[model samples]
Target: MSEEDTALKAIEQVVAAVQRTQREKDAEGFLALFHPDALWTTAHGKVLIGFDAIADFTRSVLPGASWDGEVTYDVVHTQFLRPDVAAVKVRQLYTDAEGRPESEGAPLYVMTRGGDGRWLLTACQNTQVRAA
Candidate 1:
């Protein structure tokens, strides 16, 4: 596969892992995708740095939340800034346990290819969509 293809596959896998962890309420598994120094800025404007902090945040927030519908991620774009660095834009949709729409937004993720050539999340920022 081409380098772009490989990167795309890696992104897909990471996204799948994220959804799986959320569904399972596995905070540690979710945070495992992030690098040690990763930074995450949530849609609510909360800034979380480091894997430990992120994991704690997830554990505190995600469990007991009923997620009846799937969390879907639609990749809008992917740009390789360097051979080992990529920027991705994605649209995310979340639904409640009853299948009611919870929220939708666009988010940007910066991923880095580690020494082992596996993609790891470096930073993330959510773009809040204002209602019309």
Candidate 2:
């Protein structure tokens, strides 16, 4: 596969890992998609750094929620900053326990290729979309 193809595959893996986490409420599974020092910022400007913190946050948020449907992600774009660094924009959509449409604004993810040539999330930021 070409370098772009490989990088895209890695991004897909990360997205798939997120889906699995949603299904199983497995924070550890979600943490596997990130680098050890990854940074995550929510639309509300809350920031969480490192895989352990991310795992803890996920565990706290996912289990008590009663979600009847799966969360879905739509990749908006993928940009390769270099052979080893890439960024992706994606839209996240889901329904909350109250049956309200819970859609996070578009989020950007920065990924870096590790020494093993696998892409791991380095940073993520969510852009809040005001309700119309």
lDDT of 2 by residue, 1-132 (tens): 986887788787787777677678776677778899999997788899888787788778867756676676677789989888888898777767665777656889898989998788899997876668
Q: Tens digit of lDDT per residue, candidate 1, span 9-37?
A: 89878877866787787777888889888
What TM value does model 2 have?
Answer: 0.83
- Relative to the true structure, candidate 1 reaches a TM of 0.87
Tell me the lDDT of candidate 1. 0.83
RMSD of each: 1.9, 2.6
Clashes of each: 1, 0
Q: List the residue pairs that clash in candidate 2.
A: none
Listed in order, each prediction's TM-score against the native is 0.87, 0.83
Alpha-carbon runs more than 4 Å astray in model 1: 96-100
